[model samples]
Target: MHVQLGVLGPVAAWDARGGVVGLRGPMHRAVLARLVVARRRVVPVTRLVEDLWEEPPADAVSAIRTFVAALRRALEPDRPPRARPRLLVTEGPGYALKAAEDSVDAWRFEHAVRAAGELPPAEAVRRLTEALSWWRGPAYADVPEAPWVRSERSRLIDVECRAVEGRAEAYLSLGASAEAVPALDAYVSEHPWRENAWHLLALALYRSGRQTDALSVVRRARRTLSDQVGIEPGPRLRRLETDLLRQADHLDPGPGGPAAQVWAQATAAYERAVPSDTRTRLESTAGLMRDLAVTGGGGLEAARRHRVAAVAAAEQLGDPEVTARVIGIYDVPAVWTRCDDEEQARWLVAAAERTLRTLPPDGHDAARCRLLATIAVESRGALPTDRPASGGQARALQAAGQAEQLARRLDDTSLLAFALNGVFMQSFQRAGLSPRRDAIGAETIAVAQRGGLVTYEVLGHLVRLQSRCAVSDFAGADRHAAAADRLAERYDLPLVTVFTTWYRALRTAMTQPPADAAAAYRQADAILDGAGMPGLRHGLLPLAELSVRLRHGLVPALDAQDDWGPYESWVRPLLLVEAGDTQAARDALRDIASPPRDLMFEAMWCLVARAATMTGDRDVMRRAATQLRPAAAELAGAQSGLLTFGPVAHHLQGLTAAGW
Candidate 1:
């Protein structure tokens, strides 16, 4: 597809046939121009808003979203309603534009100029001329006088200046002294203190048989340098003056002169031979890492090793596109999960964000990676049982929404499903069992199926199962659980199978025989063995549910390990209380931190209170009642249909009424 966006002249988009694309309106054009100037790096929403609005509107975000949507349609007229966009995309809290480096005139110009530096004089002159021809009048000529546009305009002008100087050098190298003279003269007139421009001008004049003119040019440079910055001309200029004075035939172009420098660079490039199997080895490394992620116990560690090697290979090859792909591995989150604490999680998130910032703005890998990183960061706050709703969680949801919009434009259903998973997880955390959750689950399932992503398909079904279970729809939950089980087995995803088995156990625990539920829990444990709990969230629910229902002996017997730190810690007390070991249960609960108004703390305190009452521990009972009362009140007010509600609140109420 020969898609070209012209910001060098008017802000215009064109197809291969040279037909103009309707950017919709002036506002839309401005937005496209702004994104193009960013050269594929993400532009934050706040920056865009500032550019699009002088005073800023109350509904700035809605208006920008509308403008970007229209611009997207204009850019890709043939795209279906939700097709992945090729030109423009949302990244994090902002938007980015994507096109071939040669398709955008400014990028084409910069690349050409850079390439010209290593070429012979004739080729360099031709390339520079072609690059300069891309400019019409000014950079983003049609855009209004916004700060972003002006800033980019200044940068482009500097690039233009560099191109002009390069062109002069190429002309001088080719013995076109007359042509070089005028070009350098014009350039120096505009950028008076550019020492290279003056030096080139002097060299051109001297070569044109005007030694006196060349000497005068050096004098002018000395004055300009002294006046502007209170410094004399540097070593190059001083050396040039000495050569001109001697009128030496051995001008020699000096050390590191343009012609000599170009030849040296070309020589170095030729000598820097890469290993024959470098690309193959990099691919092998990435493939092995991916293999370990799926089949080996190393999980994300293998993936991380692959990322480092892949990125190194890409950097060696000087391919940003390859670097992005290497970093965008779906297993990126596995690293975040392995973080031992929230601080570590936050550090990982910050690092991921930095990496995402460096990725090409609208790159598929970058967009997918941003979504994954956002989801990982947000996961810290959206754990099913966390209290006080993490401050970063809302920001994560917003980022996921942006990623979803971009994924749809890119026509990437897997990324769309992953992004939607983040949205659903956030919504579940906030509202629990709402119609929104049902709708999100259904939509994600459809996306996964359409995308033919079995992993996501399993995840989508699991979400539906969770939502159904939240509403106590055991039959519906069972159906979804069965679907998940079949998909997990078919896909050979042991983790998915474990989740499904755990869900089945939770469903049967409250309704069926204890033995049947214990068997199901045991199946999940056998699948998990002792590995893959990177954090509190991964295996918490299954362990908590099993410990809550079964006796202490049964809890340990279900797993291979007798010492399951946090997992055993949370459930062991409940088992002790149930087994009538009240003192032991009380001792077990002592280390469990009961933060005020926390749901987990309240739930645990209810059990502690009940055990205290049975053991005639009045002091412990009074403290538990005091802690449970406010926590229960808070939970009642913020009751989500997501988890088992009323148990803690009912315990607190029962205790209060009994005058404990």
Candidate 2:
């Protein structure tokens, strides 16, 4: 008589005729579960007795033997009396279930999962789906609670989750993103802490052209992680959020066509082959370059590796245009406030400069224009300081100006849009320049619209939104924000919504109570955090919270490790005063130099004024008032990109009331 065993759901056996075997009692089933948990290894009679009872009875050893005898009879019903048990054999001092792994459902499921890894995505999906079907409910559901049974059940459940995820991933690899979405959504709902499920669901949503929904899913993931897991989402999920926002083409489903198939095959062949010829090397490098231009194609770190290989190949080819093309692929979005990857930025700048030298000095062609624009953007991050008209900013502005000029002369709309981006980046370095930046933004929007540059157009709207916020034109800012969001959703550009969300939060803070505003900021911060945009909010969130609290005469518990960057010195005195160090706060206020004429000047001065008021430093308060008086109508800190304090008018009123 053939026997089939199962530990996947309940501990049970079926005879070859498909009849359920009736084990004598609960203890019999528990013994079978414990042995199956051991995976055919011997479970000593003494150990079985100890596990089955909290305190074994005097005849516990005999009881275990009796249970095993009943299990053996149920497993092989036709066995003759006094014949040795084939399925459940008694060995020296122990028992082992001598069943083939294929006869046990859990073992067969695990084997199928292992084998699926080596198969094609379609085959893997089929194998895993079948493997997953083996699970009817919790493993060993009918067995008594034993330590070994619990551990094995937990392991089986985890493996079942993996199989579900594996099948979903296989569906995704087969370009069935829409099909993957429902399963992933259900999986994440059941296992909310599974970051990979969230990542795949967001990707599937984005690929299905639900860009806004994809971003919402990411935000939900962030909140779920923070609330339930007490940790941020991992880098892969964050990277996926970033990629979704940018509408990276690679995140879209793979194309279908004869030409696309041929190209895919070529790329695969190039990846597999050694670069023995220049053509092969060029093809390989070009493929890598394309991957480097976006996230989600093995992520930013992998793309950086691709950049290295592409640059080497381009340099070897010794073609200035090719070299410039390889070096100037800046589709990866950068933080405008600071350099995230200084080494890579510097390499780009150096490579562009070298490529420019190879071209004729007097040439005013597209390649030269593009190379200069590349230097302009990369130099902002590559340079050591943020000082204007010198160092990085100066070089960046000069190159951008040249690029813009050449682009106009050539009448290349796309080139003009590209050059204007550089112009906007460098020009945004200083405060009181929002008017100029606004004009640049307008011109970019016009140029981009004419050239059908959807991404640049969205960028222009964001630029305008920031400028409007800086100038305290909330009405205008609202219009720009709406426009940007509309374009973002329409074009599947999710990243644009991140900035607009921050602007909305800031706008909310301007009108709502502090707590309400704080909640909005937290929401925005969650979205920013989900997108892995730490640079944009470095010290901004905490500073905003502190400023709002101080405005309401509330003291904040500040952390010293918060990276306030250049604003640290200006904001330190306020923190000190709040901590009851009035004398130290006054001293710190006295030591501060005139506010740097950068984007945060008015905001930083307001912080100084607030601190001065708290410490009764009339002189410092008067100095801040005199400087901020001209911009009394503007919002403090709004010009600082992703953060804002309240109105300068309000701060100035406080300074006056404090007798400054």
Candidate 3:
């Protein structure tokens, strides 16, 4: 009797434990998305007809009646055939989804967001994140584009942004200014016309001690607003600029009294004339390092300086315990946030490993060093599709295995969760799905929750989210995504925040129409670029898939260097096909290499087969169909990652079945 209808992404329903309630087809799902958005009010039959069909047939009303009847059966299977429906009750002119308010994720999200403003900072963040998590993708993603759907999508996006603003403001109030920067920067970049986002970005930068950057933000806002709209800065923004010029004390968090108190204890322990107790100094330095780690990542250069100072202090003390703790606490954010910087991560890991050699192999300090180095190696090889043959992945798995053993000996749940996360990320690179991946994710979540570790809990949710998306359970993915957002914000995990935005863009492209999908992609990419992270190759793949799927030229502008690769190469022909050069697209495919050993190849090959069919290249069409068969077969039977592959495989099979 557990019912959950989700319209934030694809129109889907799920039981309490994530079992999907089949709505039979896109038409039925579309009807449900519309009804859920109506919030129990009846959508008139004429309006439903216009929403469902661009050009209705003579029997459009009759067709809708059939869809509704089937949907009622799907929603309440035990209901008698002739009995009045409870969930999809017939109203005066049309139908309504008369379920409880909380049974619909969209309604629950709206209620949570509306309630967030009156709550405390912590509670506001929690509520806002919960509201956001219900959004799997674009509003009514699987539905065909029509006036009503488009209008509702716009309203939902505006509400979603409100939740984002609330979360960012909450983080700023809690001194998590660095975590607020990427989300606000991306928002203002996408919506330069919105002066409120500009103000928020400036405040975040100034609070993070980047006064010059804050000034640059206001300047950009004034220029853009003036040049585009022919208006001066808004009064609120002008006042903020004036405050920035005067170095207003209220702009930043008050000086950290707790940090200063910790520093005082460290200094007292170190300044004694007699030889200081080694353990006391080590503990004091660790405390000081913890505070710095919390406060440091507000800016990259600032974080680097703090890390350098800590490394020097650890080396001078030459205490493996202190050095291991220093490496463990300091290096994670540096590696996690700076996605483009692998060499620095490797250097930190090597330094930690060298320190480990000076300690006993089975000691706690050595185990801590092992855990640090393992995660760094995993980060260095995190993007498997970007470089398939790199030895870094093999080394990463070896390190993860080693770390897992160490974590067991230390009896540390957080360390064990991270060690397992590494394994889970790398294991799925060459295959579609596996039970072990789910087990790893569940165990990671369990261990992390028992230890009260928010960071590991975020990682666990990501694993579940990725696995769910891989199999195409958009509704289940939405559920996990909400938890990820809440935890990442609570702990101020910037990299996790980046991942959530990217995942959102990916879902948007998968579910929404091309134009809407492109805008979402641009927003997520801007967030990544503003954070100084390297471009994600996978992030661009969705737009390419859409261009091919929709038979239109909707490609994002790519640099010349992005013209080749397993991912980009497939995308190249898609652009050509969109530009009305099907012949050139076929020729381009001739020179490109066969797809790599991955299920994403199924998506690429399906598009290739469709493109070949369109260009009348029977030979290429046959070859692509041949190459796609095993991939489609394996994915068709695959239970875990079925969602990712199912849509593409079906399309390819349908095209092939239609004859070259």
Please, what is the TM-score per model?
0.43, 0.58, 0.47
Put down candidate 3 lDDT per residue, 1-660, tens digits, no spaces.
367888889898987778899989999888888888788889999999888888899999998999999988888887776876778878789988787766888777876776666454655676677778777878888898878789988888888888888888887766677888997888777677778888989998998889999999999999999888789988999999999999977676442246744644665565864355454554455445544333222233234445655655777787776676666654232212123455665666566667767765664744463445445433543433324435655565566577777777778775666566555544534434434555666787898889886666766676676656655666876777788888767776555666677667666656677676667656765554323244233334454335423533334354322323335566667667767877788788774565543325455566666667666667767767666554453432122221232454665666667684
Error of 3 at 153 (Å): 39
Q: How much is 512 displaced in model 3, in angstroms?
A: 3.9
Each candidate: how many clashes?
7, 2, 5
| Root-mean-square deviation per candidate | 24.1, 20.0, 20.2
Candidate 2 vs candidate 3: the lDDT winner is 2
Q: Which lDDT values do the candidates have, in the order given? A: 0.62, 0.75, 0.64
**Candidate 1: worst 10 consecutive residues by lDDT?**
636-645
lDDT of 1 at 193: 71
Query: Which candidate, 1 or 3, would have the higher lDDT against the true structure?
Result: 3
lDDT of 3 at 186: 82
